[model samples]
Target: MIIRPALATELPALRTLETAAGAPFHDVGMASVAEDEPPALPVLAASLRAGRLLVAYEEGGPDGGLAGYLMWEPVDGATHIEQVSVAPAYAHRRIGQALIDRAGADGGDRPLTLTTFREVPWNAPYYARLGFRPLTDAELTPGLRAIRAHEAELGLDRWPRLCMRREAAG
Candidate 1:
């Protein structure tokens, strides 16, 4: 797989890809999540414009299409993982991990932080396997606290959630 910055023209396709990626949630009793729309076009465009988005394209196999995408934002002292998704057909092939690895590389030596579903196999558990650890409430920075508040306002707190952090690679 080859990973590179997302192009402006690729934003719409990324949203479509993200919707396809959300489909698996329906099978896991989280159809609401699957139904949620991808972030608005302007939000995606802004992230792309800020050079905060990256996409992984297949280097081999049919057509070498987009495998997945990841986004991050500098929040507090860390690079906050805003989103990461792999189209179902391309999942389980470490595309998500590769996107994350790219983010880590571009993160400027700051820890990577994110919030995720606490019980979902592909959410918090997947991240834990990648070296993230659940952060205690006491460890939540002001930016993270605001992030959680925003999530709560969005009703994402309906399900169990947790903040997690991965240290900068040595």
Candidate 2:
């Protein structure tokens, strides 16, 4: 498998993956708790435009095929993982963890932080196993604040998020 930055041409596939990954959670209205909105294209576009999208794929596969992806940004000397998704068919295959591991490895000396839906089993504890611990709002820095603002503007629920952090490995 190979992990690398996303290319513009891969946006459609990413959107498809995002929609599929989000549907089950959305059906229960627990995925985001945000007001009804278009599926995932807008957010994906914004993340891509920011140059913060990374994709994972099996080497030698078709050019646009992806196993999973991580969307994040540099925040207060840490990498803030905004979202991670694997194609539904690809779940339980460690693609998500691989993306997280790649992010940590790429962070140099910085730490890694993320906010995930608290009730999602795959959100908090999954990261906890990797040494991330829950964090309080006071611990959030300016970059996190910006992220929070974006979420807020989108009407996303803030309390359901379990903010987490871990020091990067050297």
Candidate 3:
């Protein structure tokens, strides 16, 4: 698999992957947006314009289609992982981790931070295995205010999202 910067044309695929990833949280209304179109297009376009989106690909058996993607933004003193998803058929292949590792490598001069639900598997403990530590909301800096606003607009108010951080290797 290869991880690289996402192109504007890949927005649809990235949105598809994101919607699939949100399935696990569907009962909580996580993927509540209309399926008629991928919302990531506008966000991805804006982020790419700002130079912050990344996509991952692997040669599908005989087909050359995109495999997965991750979107993030660099704010304040950290890189915030906006979303990471692989096609439903491509789950369990470590594509998510590969994209995350790539992000860590590219996050220059800042720590990598992300917010995930407090539930099992998607929470701080899971990321701890990858070297992230949970941080209190009080610890958030002014740089992350915009991110917090976006998350709020998404209606992710249920479980307290644990803010995890890891120093970037790059």
Q: What lDDT does each candidate get?
A: 0.92, 0.77, 0.71
How would you encode candidate 3's per-residue C-alpha lDDT over 30-129 as one tens digit per residue? 5453232345467789977877788877866322557777778876768888776677666777777788888877877678888777664655666787
Residue lDDT tens for model 1, 1-170: 88999998888889998999999889888888999999888998999899999999996654348889998999998999999999887879999998998899998899999999999899999999999999999999999999999999998998999999999996
Judging by TM-score, tell me the better candidate of 1 and 2: 1
Ranking by TM-score: 1, 3, 2
Better of 2 and 3 by lDDT: 2
Q: Listing every candidate in turn, what is its Cα RMSD in Å to the true structure after a full C-alpha superposition?
A: 1.1, 3.3, 2.9
**Candidate 2 vs. true structure, TM-score:** 0.80
Candidate number with greatest TM-score: 1
Task: Flag regions of model 2 displaced more than 4 Å.
Answer: 27-51, 59-65
Evaluate residue 28 in candidate 1 and report its C-alpha lDDT on the 0 to 100 scale. Answer: 81
Better of 1 and 3 by TM-score: 1
Which clashing pairs does model 1 show? none
- For each candidate, give its TM-score against the true structure: 0.96, 0.80, 0.82
- Which prediction has the highest lDDT against the true structure? 1
